[model samples]
Target chain A: MFVRNILSAIIISVAPVSSVLAAGGDTPPIPSQDWSFSGPFGTYDKAALQRGYKIYREVCASCHSMKRVRFRNLEALGYNEDQIKAIAAEYSVEDGPNEDGDMFERAALPSDAFISPFPNDNAAKAANGGAFPPDLSLMTKARANGSNYVHALMTGYKDKLPHGVELSDGQYWNTYFTGNKIAMAPPLMDESISYEDGTIETLDQYAKDISHFLTWAADPYMEERKRTGFKVILFLLIFAGVMYGVKRRIWSNIH
Target chain B: MSNAPREKFDNTVVEWVDSRLPIFTMMKNEYGVFPTPRNFNWFWNFGAIAMFMLITMIATGIVLAMHYTADTKLAFDSVERIMRDVNGGWLIRYIHMNGASFFFIAVYIHIFRGMYYGSYKAPRELLWILGVIIFLLMMATAFIGYVLPWGQMSLWGATVITNLFSAIPFVGESIVTLLWGGFSIDNPTLTRFFALHYLLPFVIVGVVLLHIWALHVTGSNNPLGLEPKSKKDTLPFHPYYTSKDFFGIIVFIIFYAIFIFYMPDALGHPDNYIPANPLVTPPHIVPEWYFLPFYAILRAVTFNMNIYMLAGLGLLAVFMVEFIWRHKPKYLNGFLGFLLLVLGSGLAVFGLLADLNQGWEIPMSAANLAPISAKFGGVLAMFGSIGLLVILPWLDNHPIRSARFRPLFRIFMIIFTISVFILGYAGSQAADKVYFMEFNNTMLAQIFTGFYFMFFLIILPLLSRFEKGRELPKSINEAVLSKAQKAGA
Candidate 1:
């Protein structure tokens, strides 16, 4: 009876789908892609992380700021402390007031957040034609189907608008974007950044890499979370088994 | 009480402590040798599981609170900080988040088990009522906790639900303002919500204590719906049921770990990741999945009372005709029953179709006479759905306790379950527009909402009179013996 009821319920719930097909026209479906860190045992691919960091530095970093991540955090992506120090030193960051009580610029330390190109939200908006460049810190978590949406938007730019549609001046057509028009133009091109590890530098590879890097930025503890979860579950199984044995021994004389 | 002899401490220190506090005596009385029906199956394990979940949530919640900021501007960032900066904070937050979901899951199963076995009958009525009270406190706690995240759903959900008070008559506006701590959900609202969210769980803990005390007073209802007649029919709660509860907890924790580790966001709304934006309303706004059935009931009230009056009158006519034709009511039901059924079905179909089209056009004269607006009706419907549960112990007047013996009651139970699922599905749909069918989602919601109330208020009481229940086993021992004999054969 339970199975039958469940089956009937499923049928009733699913029966309306055919009638609602037209309702889905508003937002285009997001395409799915495989990730190295997709499952319980999955971990970040270190080589991709390095290439992704390079692509971010060369292309996207000028527009987007990963304000939540410090230069030292690059160690998680396989960078040594000296390399991190060198990278941080390459960028000049605003520092505290001197004896004159005025702000001054100094080479950034590894602890400093990746610097923003624009000073503030207003400046970012002004530079981008009224569209503020969003901070990249939690971008992977901010949208639905986050990584897929990011990858799709990067690769979805079209050379021509769909037949009847026309774009206003700065709007670029990207089929995956909500309105199929976006303020940011296509940021990646073929061979945009040469990887130090000799990996191919295709546009798709750059988009995927950056997506992976952003995902890590959003959830750096994914590896630890899965690891701890596995251990806890294993311990619980053994503990429960022991508890069952104790219970049997205690009740052995009864009933 | 169990026949097992109570253990006596021989040591002087143990005796002295026992004389002072009697803590061991209380524990021995309440848990060590407390008699429990041996016939209880896996379903009975949820109460223990729920208690464990409560502790897990409270423990995790206290730690999370230490690092959390209640200020609106920082609330969102603080949560992000907890996830990114604090050591082991992600695990704590995930446990709390997924814990809320699991808590509801366990409680729902627990409530359904009570309903299935007639556990709320007779001496256990107060126990059932206390459970209902706990359920209400839980809903309130979950609602405010959802807002503490300061996400899009949090802000907008706060606005929508707090505004529900505006359905009241004269002081509605003031009540909403008072609740919000201002004209809108803002800094004070977030601070107060955080305070209340922190406080209510402790309140729930208190009520849970009273609930358990009541449970102990009445003892547990077994699957057979028979009280133990002798000690042989029961087992000590300690050693036996405690081990069972431990096993249940481990199993439940495994399920929780899957959500926390593998698919943390599976139960969460994606829009919640975005910080609250008052200017941009989400395309569709829905509450957490646990609240869907009630949310759907609220949205279902799209039409005024004309439809309800018509349907009520039609049902009354059917009942009257059946009453007059008493002896041969079954054969007399064909033509009129078919006609009335079609009329009822047509009214429902029209209501849903009209809701899809927008709303039913109420005649100007009838509009004022319509006791309340549809919005207010929706609020009443939502609250009424929970309120109906309080009276369930009385509504069910069956001689037999468990549905195992009541074939007709079992059918109604199935219908009740289906209606709830339908309401949940409707609730999950976008509230602004109808989808999936030509009929409006609100209209479908209303139809299911009608079934939900009817199951409790009408079907349960009415069916109890007509149902000829099957024979039930006289005692738990007999039931167990028969099962064993069948297995041996």
Candidate 2:
């Protein structure tokens, strides 16, 4: 009866977890996407990340900002120091007051974070029709379903609306957004961005690449974290075994 | 009087320090040769693991604070900087973040162990109360520390929790303003939370010392819940329990590290990655998992009216008189038992009543909507849950300490634990439309909240008064021997 009670307790306790997850509104589930960094032993695909970086630079950079990342941090994308320096020099950053007591624009350094096109939030919102374009630094982590959600949203824009669904003036219909209507129009198109390495230039390919890049952007140290976890767990298991033996030896004399 | 005698060490340097301060002698007496009950189960290891987690949190927290900024505008950016720029900052930050969850897990198991074996009874009442004080302090520290990140959840969570104070009658608004140090949870609130977040842990440490001091005075209560009668019933604390505790810590850390490294955000709300924006609110807002059971209690239906509800109301009046003459079991059992039976019947009636009321969404008319009074009632329920724990020793007057021997109390405990879990699950989902078993989240919370309160207020007292538990083993040694013989060891 005691064992049965414990079993029932566990079963009853776990029942709510499934229900809680199921209460994610009426939206269709975000289908999982295959990625290089999907499993415990997974590592980032450098080529895909590089292509994804290009997509971010050309497309997303027009509105969204990656303010948390620095050019030097781009080394994670398999970029060399000189290449990072060259990339940093492309963007101009606002610098300190000069002798004339005025802020000046200077060439960005390797340590400088990604520069914003708009000076402030008000300006950013003004340029984007009163809707603030949020930063992309931790976008994947900020949303549920992470990479899959981003990928689906990117490819989910519908030219034909579902029956009885009417969109507002600037709104577009998407299958993934909590509300079917979205503020931003479709951003990806087939053959829109040319690839230097003979990679396919489809809208779906672009969406997947960008999603992968965003995942890496949100969690840069994931591979290192997993690696360290492996070592720590292995050492602990062995140590625990030895401690169990020691405890047995010590208690044997008494009990 | 300088009480205890110093130990004489064979080493001349050790002998000199021992004679002067007796600090070494104190350690020797308290930790080295302290007599501990021999029949302690694996549950006893949680106290040691909790201590290890506390130290881990403090160590990682100090390093995280060195890089963390506490202002509203800069706080989020500073945390991002720690993750990106600082050396091994992600590691330190993740450990500190997940350590709070892990520490709570340890302390919760420790508390449950005490409850199961009746460690809080008799001479150890103060020790149990001190442990509850530590739990409260830990909650305060964890809440304030959560705000240091200044994310969307941090801003909104701090807003929701602090606003709960306004449910009080007169000085409520003033108390809130004082707590915020301004009109809203702004820069001032962030800075003060940071200060208190750092301060409360040290205060918890001081209380923990007192908790341990109290424990040493009374000694430990074992699984058998019997006092040791002879040396054969106990063993020294050092090699015996120390090795056991070390094994527990290592095993516990292996799981801790998995969460830290593999799925660091498993227990976290994803919305927190966004920077704080006071204007925008996330569609769903939930507290940390540790606080969820209380959160569910805080939001449970307070004034919903129906047939079961009306009958329960009539019982409340009779219960008042029963409270006045609680010692008289004749009246106590008749009235209280009838009252509980009525309410207990309603537990399965949730589905039948589901069709009666619409969802619990806001913006309903004042007539049927959750009213202003509901907020105060919710606040009372949430706080009353913790307040009950502080008076738990007084509540259960049973002579038998171990629930192992008390079949009825053990069953009630299982029911109570399941209710808490149900409440936690209900806390996570939307509290409106029916999602499970023809009942909504709010309804689930209400039912479980009834069970949770019933466990303490009715079930414990009545059972403790009347229960004739099974006969116990003669001593701790006998209990251990019987267990070994049963196992064919």
lDDT of 1 by residue, A46-155 (tens): 88888888888888888887888889889999999999999999999998799999999999999898999889878888988888778887787877888888888888
Name the TM-score of candidate 2. 0.90
- Candidate 2 residues lying further than 4 Å off, grouped into runs, are A1-25, B304-372, B436-438
Deviation in Å, model 2, residue B157 alpha carbon: 1.0
Error of 2 at A83 (Å): 1.5
Model 1 agreement with the true structure over B1-489: per-residue lDDT tens digits:
334454667988887897666777778888988899988889999999999989998999999999999998899889988997898899899999999999999999999999988998988999999999999999999999999989998987887788778777788778887888986779989999999999999999999999999999989998888889998789989988998888888888888888998888888887888788776766556789999999898777765554544464467556533533242476555677667666766664554354444444654333234455666777888998999889888778677888898988888898888889888998898543456566667668878898998788667777666787988787788888789789979
TM-score of each: 0.89, 0.90
Off by over 4 Å in 1: A1-25, A97-101, A248-255, B1-8, B306-364, B432-437
Worst 10 residues of 1 chain B by lDDT: B319-328
In candidate 2, position B227 carries an lDDT of 87
CA lDDT for candidate 1? 0.81
Worst 10 residues of 1 chain A by lDDT: A1-10
